[model samples]
Target chain A: MPEYTFLVVEDSPTMRQLISFALKRIPGSTIVEAGDGIDALKKLSNQKFDVILTDINMPLMDGLKLVSMVRNDPTYKDIPVIVITTEGADDARERGISLGANAYVSKPIQTQDLLNTVNEIIKSKA
Target chain B: MAKDSDSLSKKVENFLKVFKKGEEFTQELLQENEKLRYRLAQQEEVSKSSGRGEALNEQALEERLKTLEDENKSLLDRYHQVEEENKDFANRYIEVETENNNLANLYVASYQLHSTLDFNESLKIVLEIVMNLIGAEEFSIMMLDEKTNELSIVAQEGMGQDARKSIKMGSGIIGQVAKTGDAFYRDGDPTNLKGIDYTHPLVTIPLKIKEHVIGIIVIYKLLIQKTEFSNVDYELFSMLAGHAATALFSSKLYSQSERKLTTIQSFLDLLKEK
Candidate 1:
């Protein structure tokens, strides 16, 4: 089995930790945490990631901007992007998809939902 | 003349005898021909009847084959239906498993809160529970001071330094929750992060020991992604109200007892020196 690397970007340490913890449930998954989009970009430059999970609202660079940048970049364009949005943030969710995110998971996220979405994206890409 | 007449009569008698014998032979040949024709007709009728019987048997076999094909198709349709039903059951099982995992998370949070007896550790656990479980962005843990009848901020996250340090009991929403021991939730949209007045929080849960309220967990803003509270969030809030209160109270008592023990030990040491 191939090992999967995931980049989790969020401003809140608590949320970042929770997301990383949930991602760890996947077999052979390696998670890298970033405080915001800037940190995520820095990491992206250093190493290749299989999937990117980002939150919409961040301090330095928001998730939507990161998604657009990733889509524009030749190196990261093929990587699957999953945006984390608030439950009622329909506009943000649509914007994230339009910006080239592979999928979106709503906040107050259910662990199962996050897992299912990631698994689906990973299977499709495989 | 007498001799010639006798000879002629004898010759005529012989000729009539030969003619009668030839007629008998011809009648016997005709009878034999008629019997052979009747037997051939009977054989042809029997052969045609057997051919008809074979055709009837083939028609019955073809009908049987069609019925069997229809039955096979129905069985295949049922097989697909069962396959679909099995998929639905699997999905339901996953949902139940997810619920079970959520309950496990709650149990672990509760266990961690009570595992520590240090006052600061207990406070830290409460902060983590609120941040990780409730997804609060800006919030504070306030302990009620009985003497002053006011709630003071013991710990906070994402709140500005100039945030209010205390609230008088029964004064505002947070205070009212502390006074009544009932949890307070904002009426309007909880996701709107605009016009954030620190005085009015989105949720205020009163931490209590039995009937007495000890402190309150006031949340001003939730994380950007946390638009609304979930059922599990409510369960955590309820659990925190009671479990956090007990943990803090027990740790506070333990800290006081440790101080008293130190004072007594110091007194004993002085007496021994004298």
Candidate 2:
């Protein structure tokens, strides 16, 4: 099995830690943490990642804009993207999907569901 | 037989030592493989069974979600109710504190009014009560002579030079309250001073002891901070009307009797000496 690197973008330190912890359960999983979209973009420019997990609401640039940026770009466009947000509205989920998000997970997050979704997206891409 | 047993033991120890090398690694790999196979089989069974159980699981989750939402709403309502109760308690506490302070001020003012037999000192106390307790900066205390049927200013403070030193019964706002023995408060209504220059008198309280109106206290204006008078101020005015009058009258009679006793003592001594 190939070593999978995941980029976790969330403003809250606790949520970032939770995502990293869950991802660590999978063998050979590597995680990079970013506070917001701008930091995530900088990290993306520096390294290659197999998957990106992001939150919708952030300080400088939101996850929607990040998703759009990733989808528009040529080099990193193929990277699997998953959106985790407090916004559970249909329109918000639809917007994330239209912007090329592979999956949408609402907050009050179900940890098992999130892990399974991550696994599924990664396997599908593989 | 003992030699055979020792040889078997040595064989077992040697076998254990061999097992500690690369054989341990192979055992661990086999155990891990068994665990993986078990997990994979469990996953396959779950996937097959989930086709039938998915709807039931979804229904249970929906019910749980609804219960949580209702609980959250009820907790939110309880929080708002507690906040309202706290606000009401705070308002009630402020009202109770104000009433207590007002009663204390009244007691202190009553005590000051009758603390001394000196008429001048009693009068000074009344002035202090008006300025400090009542928040009035400008006012006048006047005495009504029964024989002449005239009112004269006994103690005055913060008054304009143009203010009249005396007013007849039934002449203006002050005289009307004095004539009828009724307390009058016309705050912000300056049209009632009748024929007198606008000195902006706020209220006129008739000082009465038993049915006789002894004098009147005219409040001209409050201090800068006090914009208007409250019901509590009105209650204070009524209290002063009764208590202040009795204090002044008693102090005056007491001093007069003391002077008369002194004179009698002097006359009696002179006669006894002769």
Candidate 3:
């Protein structure tokens, strides 16, 4: 029973809550919220996180920039990143993965799909 | 001397006969011993072969047992794998069921919205649909005033009092959509809640009866966790545009008819008194 700390970054409170709700279903999972990419970076600096789930579109900084920054940083670079993309944003999904995101989930998200993606990334990393 | 020689010969002859008989008897005994030995050897060979056959059978049984044990282990492993697969499928089925339930709830909510003929109740239902189903945090339902040619807020949520100003027809985004009967959706990310002007809402659905626009549903911002509008949201919007307008219109007409009926009844009563 390993404890997992997750950093969820999204501009919309509703989406963040939904994703967090799904993530909380995993046993021993601790969730931390961020409104955008900048806020995510701040949280990353404060403490270690096992996985990062971020929405691609945001007010100040989008998820792609955050992913690239995380990938570049020596400390957080190894942490798995899962990008949340809108349903039709195929280009953005590809770009996010190319930018070093481990995996992704489309918007209008199915809770099961999101969970499976996160669980897979976490298991692979473990 | 002749008599003694004859007697020696007779004695030799008898001794020879007796010696021959003894030799013949000894030869017979030796032959019997050899036959017995051959028989013993054959019996010993048969007994040794029986023992060897038993050993081979034991070895074969041990090998068969080992093979069966291995097969049993493999079958057990396969059984566990199948069990795991079944559990996975069950989990997936439950998720699908939950999704179906949510969609059903939305359907029921929409049905209830149209069932009501009361204007206020219609507004309440619309608010619930927007807030709960659409995940709108800041929104307002503005009805078009035919006389004034303006759109006024009939019901609102999460907006300041000062923000609820009426818009002239074809004036701003909400008004233009109301005038044209075309829905207004902001380009790019709906969740990007930075510098949101109340005039330009995230979505402005013109509630229409055919080509005629009756009212507008303006959503300035969505709830924090709502990343983007889903397919169901689009469907909901399409539904509200037509059904909500008809409900509100019918209810208003019903209210007006009730008022006229009341006036006519009072006049009849007055005439009877006179």
* Top-lDDT structure, candidate number: 1
Rank list by DockQ: 1, 3, 2
Q: What tens-digit string does per-residue lDDT give for candidate 3 at B1-274?
A: 2244345546555655655565565556556555655655665567577766555645555565566556555655655565565556556555554565345445545676777678888787778678755777789999998999999999999886557579999998888999889998897767655746787789999999999999999998776668788766887799889888888888888888988999999999999999
Q: How accurately is candidate 1 docked according to DockQ?
A: 0.09
Q: What is the interface RMSD of each candidate, in Å?
A: 26.1, 31.3, 25.4
- B188-246: candidate 1 lDDT, tens digit per residue: 76755574787778999999999899999998888777778877888999999999999
- What tens-digit string does per-residue lDDT give for candidate 2 at A1-126? 678999999876545665676677566899999999999999999999999999887899999999999999999999999998643256777888999999987653445567789999888988
Model 3 chain A poorest 10 in a row by lDDT: A12-21
Q: 2 or 3: which has the higher TM-score?
A: 2
Quote the lDDT for B112 in model 3. Answer: 62
Residue A81 Cα positional deviation in candidate 1, in Å, after optimal superposition:
17
How well does candidate 1 score on lDDT at residue A121? 96
- C-alpha RMSD in Å of predicted model 2 compared with the true structure: 32.1
Name the candidate that leads on DockQ: 1
lDDT of 3 by residue, A65-94 (tens): 999999999988999999988655789999
Candidate 2, fnat value? 0.00
Clashing residue pairs found in predicted model 2: none
- Model 1 spans with C-alpha error above 4 angstroms: A1-126, B1-62, B69-73
